[model samples]
Target: MEIITINYPLQGLEDKGPIRPKTLAIGHFDGVHKGHQSVIRRAVDVARAEGLEAAVMTFHPHPKEVLGRGSEYTTCLTPLEDKLERFRSLRVDIVYVVTFNLTFAAVSPAAFVDEMLRPLQVKRAVVGFDFSFGAKGAGRAETLRELAGSDMKVDIIEPLMMDGDKVSSTLVREALAGGRPETAEQLLGVPFSLRGTVVKGEGRGRTIGYPTANIQLAGAYVTPRLGVYAVMAELSDGERYSGVLNVGVKPTFHDSLPMPVMEVHLFDYEGDLYGSTVRISFISFLRSEKKFASVQELIEQIGADALKARSVLSAFK
Candidate 1:
């Protein structure tokens, strides 16, 4: 799929001379969660039915993050790279990644439609029912439909519900924060994961006989709850490994730090992974992070955790 980055005004930015007439799916799909996928799927299906290209329009540096919202909106579930991969998997023909800054945030609804959507030759748009845009979000789904009028068609998808609650990015984040990756997987149609680079740590895991690779997250990703979890790690070379991951400070030997560190012990593997990149997918919440009375006690618990993690992760592989 082709990716086009658009600055404010969104004119004369395409590599090709003219943008194709397409059915566009518009949203800042952070995690490409189930609800977001539904919107994209509708656009693809509509485009196929009407014989138009399937395109997606997403924003970078989430509006809330750029607008100085609360800290909760600071970190993202899926970074730009992960998000684009999901779009590609959905079979989107093109992706317009509009840069979201203070200037773009000031655009009005009518001006946005006339300057961006119409110029791009959008034949139809698929949006969520609660989607809003323009300065301070003055435009809603109905507003977009009203502005489109006869020139373009609009379809507003309702919220997707699983079990009882509505499936959304916020809902997925909430589940992760609460140490429920299983719940997030249900809402996302797969496991939630983060990409990162493996860095050198204090060679402590090796001394304990359970060597681990310290991981530094690639982007501003929301760290899961402070605990140990069963995980599946994929190296940059595309090799996968089942593992036990810890997201916490080593309280037994050191003082509590400001941020929790991430490290993983890949089962039955022993080769240098330092400086290599890996994507870790959380599979199960094993237990909360705690300080053991002694190093032996901690090691014993870890052995038990590894046994439990192996049992749980076997099903995933």
Candidate 2:
């Protein structure tokens, strides 16, 4: 797949000379969940039927951040790079990553269609029912159809519902935040995961005879609630191991830490994993984090947690 980063004025697109017409799937597509997959697949189907290339148009830095409409700590379900990887996996022919800034946000709906969409040779556009664009979100699906006129086609996918709830990024985030990864997975069609690099810790886990790999998360991902969870960790070398993960401050040992830590203890595994990147998939929430009076009590509880995690993971095998 080809990735094109475009700024406001849409420069350098013509440098490649004449380009093929594209059927574009347009949205922020933060999580690239099932609902997003439907939109992209629709574009691909249209492209195949019309003999056009399937392309995806997404934005970076999030519009809410630039418009000051979101909190400072607002994060993405899947970061930009991860989202692009998902698009690639879906076999998209082209990906247009538009930079979202003040100037770009101010583009009028008509100008956006005339200068951006039409110039890119977009023959068909597939978007979700709730998608909106243009300055102050004045562009709706109907507006897009009107702007496209007879030259292009616009398809709006209705909301995808599951278990009486719409499948959406907001629901995914809420599930993760509430420590209900199973629910998130059901909505996403995949386990909720976090990727991070192993970092040095206080060596407290080793002292307690349960060595752990402390992870430093790579991006601003939505974190699960503070608790112990049954998980599977995939190391950089492509090896996967069942594990028990802890997300919290070590209340038994320290008064407090700079931030909450993600520590995973791989069941029956021993190796030097420091400096390696690992992706941990949440399987189930085991227990909430709590303070213990003594280190021995913590160790005993961890043993119980490990046993329960192993039991939970046994079904997967």
Candidate 3:
């Protein structure tokens, strides 16, 4: 899929007049969970039936982060690279990441359709049932149809629901924050994962005979509850390994520092994983973070965690 970063300096839609007459799916697509999958699937269907290319239009920096429009939410479900990869996996022909700036946000609904959608030559547009666009969100599905007139087709895909409630990114974030891994997995249609490059640590885990891969998170990434978790780690080479991760400070050492950290000890494996990117998929919460009486007690508990992690990941393997 073609990934295009759109900005004011570019020619906007006119730069790609040749790519018009495309089937477009529009949304912020924060998590690109099951609900978003539904919208993209419909867009692909429309593109196939209408004999046009499929594209996804999304806002970057989130409208909220750019314009300070609404209540601030936690980080994102997927980072830029991961989000684009998801769209490519869905077989989207193009991904248009529009920079959300004040000038762009000020564009009215009609002007947006004329300047952006029309210029893209959108033959058909797909959006969530509650989707809204343009300045102040003045444009709804009904308004979009009116603006398009008879020149384009608009498909308002219905909201995807589970247990009688709409599946949304906000709910997924809440679930993860609350340590409800099962619920987040249901919405994501996959395990909740964190990807980052392994970095050097204090070598404390090494001294304890359980050397771990320390990971660094991006600024806009959201972490789960501070505790121990049974997780599956995917190495850069695509190999999967089960492990126990500690997501908190070294309380066992009597350290008062409150730096949140992630340290994963891979089971039955040994190698130089430092400097390599690893993706950890959370399976289940094991226990809450606690201060142990001594290094001996902490070691004993870690042994138990390894045993439990092995049991849980056995089925996954």
> TM-scores of the models, in the given order?
0.98, 0.96, 0.94
- Taking the tens digit of each residue's C-alpha lDDT, what string does model 2 give over 119-144? 89999998899989999999998899
Of 1 and 2, the candidate ranking higher by TM-score: 1
Per-candidate Cα lDDT values, in order, are 0.93, 0.91, 0.86
Q: Give the candidates in order of TM-score, highest first.
A: 1, 2, 3
RMSD of 1: 1.0
Quote the positional error of residue 291 for candidate 3 in Å: 1.3
True-vs-predicted CA distance for residue 184, candidate 3, Å = 0.6
Comparing 2 and 3 on TM-score, the stronger one: 2
Highest TM-score: give the candidate number.
Answer: 1
What does candidate 2 score on TM? 0.96
The better candidate by lDDT, 1 or 3, is 1
The lDDT leader among the candidates is: 1
Candidate 2's clash total is 0
Alpha-carbon lDDT of model 3: 0.86
